[model samples]
Target: MAQPDVPDCPVDALTAECLSRIFSHLRPADLAAVACTHRAWRQAVAGEEGLWRAHCEAEYCLRSPHLPAGGAASGYKAAYGAWRSEFGRYGELAGRALRAWRLVEDWTAQHFPAVAASFGMGASEAELDAAEQQLGFALPPALRVLYRVHNGQELQFDRLVDIQRTAAHESIFHGMFGGYSFYSHLVSCRMLPLRRMVKWTRTAHTQLDFPRGDKRALFAASHNFNKMVYCDAADGLVKIACVDKENCLQAVPADAAGDPARDGALRWFEAYAAALSSGAFAVEALDAENPATIGICLFPQLPPGRSEAVTEGVRVRACPLLIPELTQVAEGERQYFFAYSIRFSLLPEEEQAALRGTLAGPAGGAPLESVQLRSRYWRIRDAAGQVVNEVRGEAVVGHYPLLRPGEGEFAYQSCTHQREPAGSMEGSFRFVEGSLQAPGREFDAVCAPFRLDVPDFIF
Candidate 1:
């Protein structure tokens, strides 16, 4: 006994907004079904762009499809359909790849904005197929997803020497992935686009002893003569082609590389992303006063890879770097040359106030009126915990830095040879509250114990 005034369909009585809200929880396939039900249902569902956008975001982790140029989201429904057709097979892997890049891009935006902008747009299926066809092989599943997310980075500068000169002047254009700079050279690493990667692979094979039926391609490299990173299609290993001596290839140990069977390119990308998330790497300002001096550096920010402490609002971060090139092993004699960097800075009053209760000495505390490096005391020990060398020095490498609050850390790198394969360094630095010229209150900034062991991953 339906009333004459009542509408025949339930949706006829409901507003479009309510219908849209109900449709939001439905899957894309179900929503498409709703669209085909009747003219009223189709009209109600067809125009709800938010619903389609939400589905795209949830499934692909993309804010916009940005398809067919002009960024016309006039039809998010079209965008969702396009994404499904393009990347549906990748599924969870595509989402993971997107999320990984998002993390790296976020870090880059916060620290080095220009470099973040250098990342190339994703490659299409046709482009990827062309690359594969040219190479006579296929990219791995995970790697395929990565390329579909971002082809790679295009370095903006001309050469490594330019980057070196820029860094020497304390001006840096971070490229690819931001790298650490010291002394005369800047070793900025950048990812190569697929086309460039293919070209480099051909060059590498031609330069080296070419192997038949093998696909070893250079995927990334420093702008200079550091090391070239490669992906092996035959074996899922991300390797570094060492240029020194025999030019031996070194793959990251399985211990550091999770799930060895996974595609090396994807593993490398995910590992880099993990490093950013875990504080193993940080983008920091090279100079304290110049915010523009910020760049990406591989100075570890967490324990194991790094040791840190704050004394009287001054923070000291020390990390060890393994020089595999200098590593010597011969009959009962194993020598490992390790270089360590000491970066210390006096915290600004405002930062100290902000870090109160969170950081050690700054907890509801006071900032240093002034600080100057005076001397260093380091106790280097071997793997057996026996003291190898005890260094008591007036100034680190001959410069006593006059620390200033809010100015960047005074960073220095020095090499030390260890008798054993592994060792540990524990030390402290003497600093005066005022300048070295004008003596005032003094304190010993503790340099927490840090390891000198060779890492599984030799980057």
Candidate 2:
């Protein structure tokens, strides 16, 4: 009996349909592991379109419509393969963006507890599923994580802290009471709370009446400026729309989108998280009615070394790179990488008492606030006027430069990666007399527009 015993074929013995049923129970990663078992198993699993599709759907919530086209095969398995490949490239990036958002949450809770309290708890899977169903599109991963941590939040702004509606309040004092009449008053003002964001967004999408091809898409946040920050599904970028504009709703680039360091669409969630982490901007709130009593004073918190550096006077000027050096990029890609130089100079006059008065008080000894570059946001356009690339963010480099008079210039490098044959770059530097929070007078130093060109290859 022992001599007659024999081993059966491991997994290859299973029928294709049986194998598919078994693999369906595995996650995407587990499915991948078993795929390398044997030639027969690999072919059997790879060809099982339904199995791969099920894995993709379970992991990413991706359906047929969300899949990419032009694969060698026009089956679900090919689409799943394409998505898996793209996920491999972008998955880590999505994680980094989520980490950045979590940092922002921690910062907000520590610095602005009252505002943070309104954020609530992280979203549940069912809520996310409902939101996706309602929006009719899959949210980007970072944005999904952002909502899970907190449904939405209020940004900090001092003087202009509330969104203005077209109808003025009958009586501001009377509207403060808590009752049925107060509830009606709140609705009349068009207050947009993040928890009910989906409802208002649906209304905006259906009733606001953007052009036929241009839907209102989805809203990310509502601002005190009578604007709702929303996504343009047409471009997958974020834009700010004037909700209380004269006539129809008009959308414009959000502040982050206006910066040269950002994508033209501002790529919404990721860019916002990055901006918070980078200290390029701060979100603060104000609730006091009296400006004099407002708690948002910008003085008295100057960094220790800042006052000493500014007291001597710092000269600041803009230096442009008329020519940029270019290098060939990756294989099979036509893009070129160019590096441009920017130099800053601090003039002797920056130390004068008149300058001190404008910056800090003449008696206080001015501590420099910021040296920012302000210009029309830069972009590279092709012959058809399509934006090949757009830059965004604040300041030329991440930090403000402190330069001395006449001795030397502070040099920094900026780069642009473009596939276009020709394009140009231009912008100006804005010097903040005080600090970022309480910026005084802003002085503009312009950088004239420069051409981006590539010569014919000799070799």
Q: What TM-score do all the candidates reach, one by one?
A: 0.73, 0.36
What's the lDDT for candidate 2?
0.43
- Per-residue lDDT tens digits for candidate 2, residues 1-459, read 222222334454547668778878876677666766555566677777778667555544445524432324366666666655544534544334335455555654665344444444555557876876776665544445445444554333311234434333222111100001111111101122334556666766666665555533444432222334554544444444432321222122334444433222324444444444444332211111222211111111122201122222343222111111123333454454444444465544444445665532223454443343333245565645566667656665555654434445554555565665565665555655555555566655544454554422100
lDDT score, candidate 2, position 371:
40
Instruction: Show model 2 residue runs off by greater than 4 Å.
Output: 1-90, 135-142, 154-195, 223-225, 242-267, 282-459
For residues 258-330, write the lDDT of model 1, one tens digit per residue. 5544555665677788787666776665333345556666657677798888877888899886655455554
RMSD of each: 7.0, 17.7
Cα error of candidate 1 at position 16, Å: 9.9
lDDT of each structure? 0.70, 0.43
Instruction: Tell me the deviation in Å of residue 336 in model 1.
Output: 6.3
Candidate 1: residue pairs that collide? 288-407, 288-408, 357-363
How does candidate 1 score on lDDT?
Answer: 0.70
